[model samples]
Target: MSSGKYAFTKALKELRFHHCQTSPQSQAARSFLVRAYPTMKKHNPQTPILIREAQGIEPKVWARYGFGKERMESLAGLDEKAIESKVTEMATSEPQS
Candidate 1:
């Protein structure tokens, strides 16, 4: 019984470590995406370097002003609901000339 508990604890620790590593990778990816894709770097020109790392459809601080596959793929892992919400948010938040 104690061995089983130890194994579970060990597994959880390993999972946590993996999660931590993936987080930085995703953050770096997001940062690189913002810079490599022009549209993403357009919005809020003052802080073009701000990279959004949220999982849901929050307006990416980087690519809030343009449209394309670059935008879609930046949000590729989000679910339908989150994507819809992001679309709505983007639609509402666009700056009017």
Candidate 2:
């Protein structure tokens, strides 16, 4: 924030919305984000997103599981290297539908 390295941190920062467990809006948002960038939900949200020149790291977003407060998958962090690796993994892991 101080560096102005990140803009729209409010919209894109570590959002603690339990996408899988509640309101349609959040669910839709999470769905859209996942489809656009499927690995956004894999890391701990409290994890610091630090980077040297990847512009800015992606914020960790998380969702809660069913019922009472269990965590679900995250889109993971957004560093270039981490994103690359995650993309590779997702590519390999996809069922090719």
For model 1, how does the per-residue alpha-carbon lDDT over 28-53 read when each residue is reduced to its tens digit?
34443433334422332333233333
Deviating ranges (above 4 Å) for candidate 2 = 1-76, 94-97
Q: What is candidate 2's lDDT per residue for 10-92, written digit by digit as tens?
A: 22222242233343333443444444332333332442332111222333334222233322233432444443343334322
Report residue 2 deviation for candidate 2 (angstroms): 37
Least well predicted 10-residue stretch by lDDT in candidate 2: 1-10
In TM-score terms, candidate 2 sits at: 0.21
| Candidate 1 accuracy as lDDT | 0.31
Worst 10 residues of 1 by lDDT: 10-19
Model 1 steric clash pairs: 40-62, 40-63
Error of 1 at 59 (Å): 14
TM-scores of all predicted structures: 0.24, 0.21
Can you give the lDDT of residue 65 in candidate 1? 39
> In candidate 2, how many Å is residue 58 off?
8.1
